[model samples]
Target: MGLGWIRRRTGHRAAKNQPGDLDMEALIPDHFLCPISLDLMKDPVTLSSGITYDRQSIDTWLEGGNFTCPVTNQVLRSFDQIPNHSLRKMIQEWCTENKRYGIERVPTPRVPVMPNEVSEILFSLAGSARNLDHQGCFECVRRIKNWAAESERNKRCILENGAASVLSAAFDSFAGDCGKKNAIVCEELLSALSWMLPAFDEESHKYLGSKASLHCMVWFLKETDDLSVKQNSLLALKQLLSCDDHTKHAEALAEIGGVNDILFKLIREKISPAITKASLMVVFYLISSSSSAGEKIKLSFLEMGLVSVLLEMLVDSERGVSERALAVIDSLCDCDEGREKAYADALTIPVLVKKILRISEMATEHSISAIWKLCKCASRQEERVLVEALQVGTFQKLLLVLQVRCGDDHTKEKTNELLKLLNPYRAGLECIESVDFKSIRRSF
Candidate 1:
């Protein structure tokens, strides 16, 4: 009675006054609150246990791998959430009645997508792909992409119902003919696939790992001028390269003409951090796959001025790009030509020295490994390289690295060996400083 009397008085005054004049705290009923979030349910949905929760709250619960109702703790028979239209309408009406208290009415919620709806979309796409119906496939994929963009629930439903295989097949079919219409459809398909990237299963990977699929992605990377299309293509290729039979895929990618050059171009352009990182990772995978393919790709990358491009990226303040650049550099230095190219670059020694113990543990390890390779393989300019290492604080960083045990045992051994190599030059710094390190270049 006391609360009711107060609310009546306040509501009367609020009706005559403007919004926010009356405090609505303690006025909202308990039944209007969602069980999980304890907030007003805008889009109320009822679970199988006859409990109502906000759609977003229940979705988050289910998506987090929980299988039971939050309050009852009973295992859910199905993930389907029935919309509580009556409760939502009540909440909306309450909000409208209390408009003077600054309450905003929630809009009518869209019907949630179901698994069967997703299956229907996929069926249409498969039919279009099978018949090579470009227009039909385009319409179907556009619908799927729109749904995917709507909600996480829709994406989960779309992927769970087998969107990947259908999209891959459609992409492959459209990719065969690179005409204007087909390119448009392929771009749309890539846009849709980007949403489900790196979440593909083994079956999906099989479709994406095919030789024709690999070539199609490479084509997008090379020929497409659109930034987003290129980015999505890189994302797809990265996921494909991470599959079980990635080495075989890597070999196939290496055989593609000008693939290394295209990757280098993307890195050099500095288009965006994400694109740059994905491109670098793709390069890493290609060059680190199998011995034969890795060597071939590494040599190709080295010839395309890979050292210069990586050195440029190493100076970037972005830790991810810097770390990846160091890693690729380490791999590149495994070969004789790679080391020679690195030594030829004036920025190589100083950059490596600057990154050691400064970026990250992994970065420091890569920097040290690259330095070891350069100095260890220096036949003509061995003393000069060692002197440069000492002059740039490499000796001190190596000592500190050992003190901290920054990397694995192999890295530690390399650090120790590097320290040993640079230790002798410490006392001879005075005489070593007399020579011009920049002018001393080895004949490649």
Candidate 2:
């Protein structure tokens, strides 16, 4: 919104669209599309004349703040008053179609799938000046969603056949289309699938759980990174974990591995805490979703020695990595016996100790939850080791954490019981104080 935020457009269109970026045709419609404004819509600023759209004026009028339009020298006080009728029409249309989807969810008859040409037309329309027409924009969004749903069903088949061009185009178009842009669609899709799953005929399973489609699910889970997307993807994957759908979990995990270089950059380099939280959840999915995935996450964790870095981040004045670390540890706790043994043999103490230490630094409920989980997992043998490890300062760290972070009375009670074991304690005192006197009576 600020003039300073705008840069004089530089690179050639070819450079901008080289392989990894949004394509021009996919970005917006060519006709009536202003070359200078890109996706924001072109100038004169207002849909009509006389009282023109003023970016800073709108911003100031709203009294939120002020901003200048990038193209026209106009003031905008808020996005609400930017008189773009076409954009409004598109948005209204989108909202209406959304309602239709809601109605269908409530028990409407199934609509016939729209023709492929209609989908192409809708994709093109979304790119054009027609994109500003409220009704037209909304229709464009509707067509995009329907097409995405159909394409998603087809994605796995295409992937298995190795139809790279078709798959890539579908992936790009789906990401560019706003109807498919947010997490809501995935959430709805997974929710509907849950009802249908129990009664799924093999044909339905073949389509929905196809190796290609399952891979796409992983792709969406890892690539999208929106919070809602992250949460729903985990839910869908959790559902899949219980079914035969996870026969491909290892392959899905491998496809996900292709993207960890990006995550490594995100972890070591700067990333916003919100994005970091989702990143950690996705990582947890990678590990906890299957034993094979657990192997992959463990290897990556060791390669990165993420625990040390996460600890350093735990002490960060601004942000910390305690949640992510806890997730990794949780996955380790569940892995198959061989892998679990490797974890206990190699990592159990170091990772848990670091997380316990971090509990003191974090003010969030999440950190406390992580410590409680660690307490639940430690064997009495591991507990003794942990107690020995704590001799330098560990018990105090957990005590301070419990003082603030304990979420429930039961967790606090568990903590007290564990502490009494670790301390210099009278052995019979714990049994005497037990909720059941059976242990004390047996002792007697």
Candidate 3:
């Protein structure tokens, strides 16, 4: 039979049979299949637009720059994927019945940790840690960490229930001991604490203030060969460094034993993008915090060739990554050493100029600010830099910025300052003009 004819006949038969369709092959309901993949959904997740699809398919769709419902074409308010647990159970049940037809049964999915469960775990952990119940605390910390690792929501719960205080106290009790048991327990607690640090801000001061917690996290970053543990430690340390109010914490982060070296190695090795980005953020916070310590941190990053790393990241296709990379560059360029390093890279000026209108407004703000810093702080040794900017069509890009209103007031002000600076350097008092301005304006 022709495939089209068969499909039409089957549709008629299906409509006639309705819910009574009992043929084994066609028994699988239409709703069981993902709209995108046309297969039984192993893990169904519902979109904000009220459409359901297999998790892998929907993740692929969203990752492919889609933000609308596939079935309804409605605009989505959020990208959050909610698990359709009831649909998943039905699909699994159907798969089980069709095993004779060679259909494999879907495995049960892991249940995300609930907030109440996390609260129970946190309460037990706090009570155990307080009563010096090392074994009890160890078990509780392990459970809490597993829960936090399972979901972002659970991580927030872990933080809100005083996980930080509990973990810090546990680490302090065990940090001084050199036995294998103590070290193992502390490592477990530190791993758990790291996952909660990003969301929980209540214990930032207390947790970071503890010498034991700092030492343990630093030790984990420096001594551990496991990338997962290192990634967690980096995240925990980043929160501490970012949230600490005292200059001592900032200075400690900047001068911590092997901190910069480890960060440099991670960035240079490109182990994992997540790890590198976390390390970069830690360095950014460390450098951007204290004015007295800023120069030292800036010099540290410059010496580590961060300018080259950041310039490369600007070309990344992902806008979020590019935006963050630019933010670090902006922080680094606040000092003369950093500005000189940035200007020295051959790609720096052109990349900054190109990204002005192409990236997000925040990115544009940082790019313009970095360029202005370079131009505003230009020295006698780098007089040709301005000429280079003009030669590379920086003036045309700035004019485009002025015309398009691609960003906020800060962006406009920076562009104006850069143009004012360049005006003086223009040859023969001539106003720079671009032939494509009219077309470019229309596109913008």
Candidate 4:
């Protein structure tokens, strides 16, 4: 009877003290809570406004392009954040006392990198690059990359300290060097540049767009077996070509012999979905930048068998890859040579028809646009293309697209035109059936 009574009492106490049954917020001191997150303060820091918050929460608020305090709503006089060591210690003590309540003590936060430290690192990198000290450059760049990965605050500090300019200068300085050590240094520099891309200034963009820098990227893309090196190279090229003078850059890329072939090879290899997408974007940007360049590049791409590669990409690629592939195809079909190449490929029309209303609105739009060009612009091959499209259920798909309003006004217009082109033959099944695939093959 005594044992039974003790067991009943213990069960009641355990149930009463259950963590889920307790109001943890009520137990914690109000001042111990971060104003931003309303949770226990970990790594508390004080703003210039005399308001305290968790370091991470405040860092996030500042990093989100805000120049004012979250609580006070006053414009910040400076970006300096002072560590609230006293409050952090108090919170830790409270957590230690509440260990039985499942509270864990927050670990001490590491001090964020300051602007001066970033400046020193950049100086070291510049000096190493100037002296042709590949080893020193590699070490400095690796450290910078580590800092970039540490925290958003570190990244902000690094960028503010002019890391992008220094890195680009180093990259341009080492442009002519070719050796294992230099290659490794170059790769590290590119990786660091990739991290700083979002913060690249006008000067950095100019340096990256220069002839030597562009060639360096092309060299990495063509020679390096490292996946990361190739990826970073593609990313840099994509950024450079995305600027306002993209046509000039595109022409520059073309002047770098074998760039088109290199990009096509990357796409054909299917190394990784990201690399493939970047390669495709570079190609798309290259051809779509200027009409003259576009026509020349499209013709060159067609001769190199770009249409077949795009058609194959459409089969099982991710939505983004599929959308880009369709976009490229749409761009390609703008030229007569592009349309002929697309028509010559047996998979082209069927792939375009299959893609409509299946992938995305943009994909549907691009697909419809390409089909319009192939069927409407083929001149002598127009009838044969329409017959082939109808045979492959293009007529029915077009009608479905219209009923569902799958694309934009332009797509709707193309859809209606294609329907009109195929409607007459839709009733004449024997005329479509009698169309010779052999004759269509010869028309190409």
Q: lDDT scores for all predictions?
A: 0.81, 0.42, 0.73, 0.81
Instruction: Give, for candidate 1, the lowest lDDT window spanning 10 residues.
Output: 1-10
Candidate 3 overall lDDT versus native: 0.73
| Residue 31 lDDT in candidate 2 | 25
Give the TM-score of each candidate: 0.85, 0.37, 0.67, 0.84
Model 2 gets an lDDT of 0.42
List ranges where model 3 is wrong by over 4 Å. 1-120, 127-134, 146-160, 175-183, 244-246, 312-318, 426-444
Which parts of model 2 are misplaced by more than 4 Å? 1-251, 255-257, 260-262, 271-274, 317-321, 333-405, 424-444
Top model number, TM-score: 1
lDDT of 4 by residue, 104-154 (tens): 778887788888888898999989989988888988998888887878778
Q: What lDDT score goes with residue 324 in model 1?
A: 87
Q: For residues 117-166, what per-residue lDDT tens digits would candidate 3 score against the true structure?
A: 76787678768766667789878887886776665556655676676776
Q: List the residue pairs that clash in candidate 4.
A: none
TM-score of 2: 0.37
The better candidate by lDDT, 3 or 4, is: 4
